[model samples]
Target: MSTATDDGTREDAPPTPTKKQRRAAGIAEEASGGIKLILVKLIGLGIVDALALYAAFVLVMHEQWLVTVLVVAVAALVNWIYFSRRKLPAKYLTPGVIFLVVFQVFVLIYTGYIAFTNYGTGHNGTKEQAVSSLMASSLQRVEDSPTYGVTVVERANELGLLVTDPDGEAFVGTNEQPLEPATGVEYDGDLAVSAEGWKSLQFADVLARTDEVTALAVPYSEDPNDGAIRTPDGQSGYLYVSTLEYDETAGTMTDLETGVVYSDTGVGAFTAEDGEQLLPGWQITVGFDNFVRAVTDVRLAGPLVYVTLWTFAFALLSVATTFFLGLFLAIVFNDMRMRGRKIYRVLMILPYAIPSFLAALVWAGMMNESFGFINQVLFGGASIPWLTDPWLAKVSILIVNLWLGFPYMFLVCMGALQSIPEDIQEAATVDGAKPWAIFRLIKLPLLLVTVAPLLIASFAFNFNNFNTIYMLTDGGPRDSNAPIPVGFTDILITMVYKVAFTGQTRDYGLASAYSIIIFLIVAVISIIAFRRTKSLEELN
Candidate 1:
């Protein structure tokens, strides 16, 4: 290119840039890139720091000191690693390590810990909390108790009662704080309407939080025997005393009316001589009791055994049925003579395109015994009891799962089939082998070589197929005779879910134990299946 010189004469520019000029241009580009990279890094680190700060704040508020420290430390380490020029590998590996620990290692460790404890409803708190809960639940109004004028107050989001005693002394108390003499107390008639640093709730506020106000029990003193003050209407406070007295030194609770002393037997609860135990027990380690209960407890053993067997059958059969059907469809459509192959392939995958959970729900409606599409329309109003009967429910689940699962297998098999070298099949044909012989000896083995791992994965998925079983039958056809609410259709996962969440008394420890067993079972099966697939690898 040419440029006009200062004298207005056309002159040729340098044919190539000088080394110094090129070096200067390269330096400028590198500087701009460095600035952009620094900006991006700072923005990324800022977001990470903000999230870490939030997580640390939450952990500290929950008194999880160790976790809060870990969060802060991790965030600091991340910032240091990214900011440092020397730690290139660390900057790349940090995210994966963090995610693996948070999502995998932590979950496995927590689940294992829960499996060894009685961390369920009524056994979810510390001993002190349990004692307090027990005492609060057993509170009864003192006979001939004089009503004190009360005003509901709040400070720092905590509800308190401003009480005017019979002698006209004003006191303020919250759930955490015992009654103390109030300063700067304002009165509306005899009622202690307000106190310093506390906002007296208006009638509307009291009405809005009626449940909270009514449930609030403010201690009259630090001593449990002294009782607490409670209000029903937020306007009148009554002295409600606990019927049980806790002896801290003895670790015993005495029923005042019955003169019965219940002592802590180290079984997590205050137990009486007659084998009766108090509710709201503290959590305790039970060693292998939960695991033992699953295998040996008379109430759970029979149902669990049946559920385990059924789970195996369901997973195995689901894999078999889906694979064969999908393989057949893929083979038929893969033929060169088949017209509109793309359209057929698309139609075949339509079921796979819908979300599994939604499909399960739709199938659940279709299989409804009375009003379902299957019984009403397909069977011309026949009452099949597809979900209610035990055998029939199993059949219904298998059918629905087959429908939901086959399309995925079909897509996989189609790709594998199409990828097989055409020359091998032609050579088999030229060798005068029958079609069945060629497929049986050549195609099926090769297909299995590619599809074996997928088959194992499919089995694992169907084994934990909670959505299909849950949405379809909800593990119903209830086995009332069993101790817990189990059903004929319940798989191991569904059974664990029911034990943990569905009933009035949730046994999270037992559920976690079941979950551990399930994990072990799946892991073992997968290991064996993968080892077996080594033979298939030889075919490749």
Candidate 2:
């Protein structure tokens, strides 16, 4: 390497620039050249962008795909344009902001708009689907249709159906047998007529044979107008339908033999003129029915309301108790000179280390009413009603939740306490401030500045700690007197579980509605907590 001379320039006795300096100066020149090259780069980018947009239009709209593709493609293009723009970082942020505004804000508001209307199970039917499902039709039941009792006689892989009538007439039919009618009858080794040449018929022949026949003494029952006839035993019925007439245009079905018209009313179900509704395919739109049911449905409202209150109470108590105990423990353990402090700290954190659900289950067994240690301690040989009673269950839940939660607070406090300057406490002590005065005036205010946010977060977590509530009590004792099968220990989420899924089948729409409500509540609380923390930060 050449050293610089006193003139402040490197002197290797060279009159020309070195390759390294030329490259260094070239990089500097490149940096100072500004966005002149960037413009050309942007122009190329624009050409590529134009090609992509054209391709997207051709592939999305002009292709066989639905409008959804076009929407997504345009959205992607918008994001690309915003990200590629050589403006400020805030300018790039505009696309994300617009996306969230358009989709999350507007689309979500639109969904809420739809939710207010009749949007539940039956009401999910589109206008076209509803109209099609609600159409009307005519049914006809033809009488005296030729009918026969079919008995499948199978040996090995080959199968044959023996068709018999009430008059002891019999004919052997196979897969090739179309709707061919037999004229001769045979019974008990007596042939009423000699069989002419055997006729080989196709399967379609039998299906197309619509001629009415007399009812026979079969084991099942069927409609006489159609090939459907009932047997004397009443265990089964045989009914043959022609065209299986369903009026897709009218949204109704017609029995071609009975002349019965089943019409769809779009409310309740498909009702015949005689007021008999079909088994299914009926869609109804009852406005606010779900909300009304949720309020009035004894099964849901009673448990839901009580559980909701308990949920709030649990969250509040859990926060208050955990905070105080944790803070106290944190203060005691914060002393640097405390003996075996590391061991004690590790032991204190054991509760958090243990899986909470497993711990809860173990505790539940220990608190069991039949043969638990609590009963032995309290009643010499009997158990306490810890799990059975409502109040006791709530209290037990709070205790268990405290054990699971306080360790976290302690850990946070320990870290925050270290950051509190010793000088502040020393100054307070020297100024005649008492122990409480030092803590209250100096340590606590500083601790709050750090831990207030954590406190709010803990509150939020405890608010939705479904596992704790469920694992502890399972909302028990079968409150049969209550509207639903809710227990005293139940919370809102558990109540929702019971109301939505414990029935004969799951009710998804009602569950979705309840979830939306809970989401709104959590969102509002989070926003409030965030703002409050911000205010505290500002104060600090």
Candidate 3:
């Protein structure tokens, strides 16, 4: 290689490696890397293969052929990719991309799909399954039928009741075939105790599975209208008939005793003329009815508006209070003259260091209305409802949230403050600018560029901070005025939770609509806030 002197003369000085020598060096380095890569890939892929095999077996058993096929295919693809000598970029990205698709993309898509369907507590399964469930649940004992001696048995991997009529004729039947005579039998007594094509559940096994035994219903015949045999007590089976009859051709359930025909309402349930609904309704597509109900249903709409307002208030106040308090502390501690600054900073962050939910629980205990530390010890037994009174409970939540949230803001503000050049603040001081004016005009705007996005995130987090609200008050100080499952302190998220779980109104579709609303609110607000944040960046 040669280099030009000041006069631009080039001179050849030293011999460089030939192309073949360079290629050899590259090959040697690549060979070393290849061995290490092979070992890592083999170990990782082996574990993945083992897990895939287990998952495929489970999926196959569940009759989920598509998922089973996909799992096996993914395992094969992974092996092929890692074993190949190409696609370096794909090798690095494969794991993260796969995980993102499965965990995030799939979940969001499923939730969105559920939001559009009536997939709640009652409306959970197919129409056929729901009809079967209704039929099974509505069974009544046949009083005039002959009493049969019975024992619980297994046939074709299904539980059945082995029975014999008053004459001691042996029969083995399941819920699907309530009374089919046993082909092969060895009578132990008048009970006709032993039967072929059946494996008797031992007396000990019956004792162990009391719930299963009680739930067991063996059909008398393939025709459900023929009635079934149910063994309430393990020793004997009773002939039972369903009061409601399902007509497959008509797609209707008829009450046998009452003669009331319940036709499919296409509203996730079977309904009669009087609007009586059958229990355990089927899942159905409802279009935008869930969203429509959220906005138009009398029970939900009124409480939802109040909850949305409170949600906004709670999130805004949380962000504002925490941010200002954190900024104040950050400014105070940022001073070089402050004593034990590091210790103070560490003590300040202790709240953030502990889990937020745990902190919320501790606060809940401290702020309890009756016989609490705040009421008894601090207030001298005043019975001040820190968590019960509507306005006070709201205040209490804000105070608790501030305590839990400010530490995070403090840490972020402290970091952002330190990043600001000291010379800029010093220049303002030399220019005779007052502390407040300088902060408002210069330092604050600069700090925002770093912290504004976090503030927006904090607001979004507080908007749906379910744990804090739940563990603290469980969204209480009940709004008895409204019929819906809501409270004065209830935010939209907490109210959705109540609608889905805590009360009888386990309407998951409605809850999901509420969630989609929340998502839109957060997404819009974030977009606007981030857009405004761009100005802060430009200010810097």
Point out the higher-scoring one by TM-score: 1 or 3: 1
lDDT string for model 1 (1-540, tens) is 899989999998878989998997786555435878899989999999999999999898779999999999999999988878667668779999999999999999999999999889889999988888888889999988899999999998999999999989999998868899998988777777889999999999999999999999988887777888999999999999999999999999999999999999988899999989998899999999999987889878788889999999999999999999999999999999999999999999999999888998999899888899999998999999999999999999999999998999999999999999999999999999999999999999999999999999999998999999998889888888888888888899999999999889999999999999999999999999999999988887
lDDT scores in order? 0.91, 0.62, 0.85
Cα lDDT of model 3 by residue, 1-540, tens digit? 787878889977778889999997787557436767679878999999999999999898778999899899999988887777665557778999899989998888777888899988888888867876788888988778777788878766777777878877777876545477787776767876667777888889888877888788777766666667778777887788889988877878899889999998688788999999987999998989998998899877788888889999999999999999999999999999999999999999999888988998999899988877988898998888899899999999999999998999999999999998989989999999999999999999999999999999999999999988988888989988888768989998899888888776588888888889889999999999999889777786
Model 3 residue 333 distance off true place after TM-score fit, in angstroms: 0.7
> Considering every candidate listed, which one attains the maximal TM-score?
1
lDDT of 2: 0.62
TM-score of each: 0.88, 0.58, 0.86
* Model 1 TM-score, all chains together: 0.88
The reply for model 1, stretches above 4 Å from the true place, is 1-58, 86-89, 144-149, 155-157, 164-173, 176-198
* Candidates, ranked, lDDT: 1, 3, 2
Instruction: Name the better of 1 and 3 by lDDT.
Output: 1
- CA deviation > 4 Å runs, candidate 3: 1-47, 50-69, 87-92, 143-150, 153-200, 220-223
Best by lDDT: 1
lDDT of 3 at 53: 100
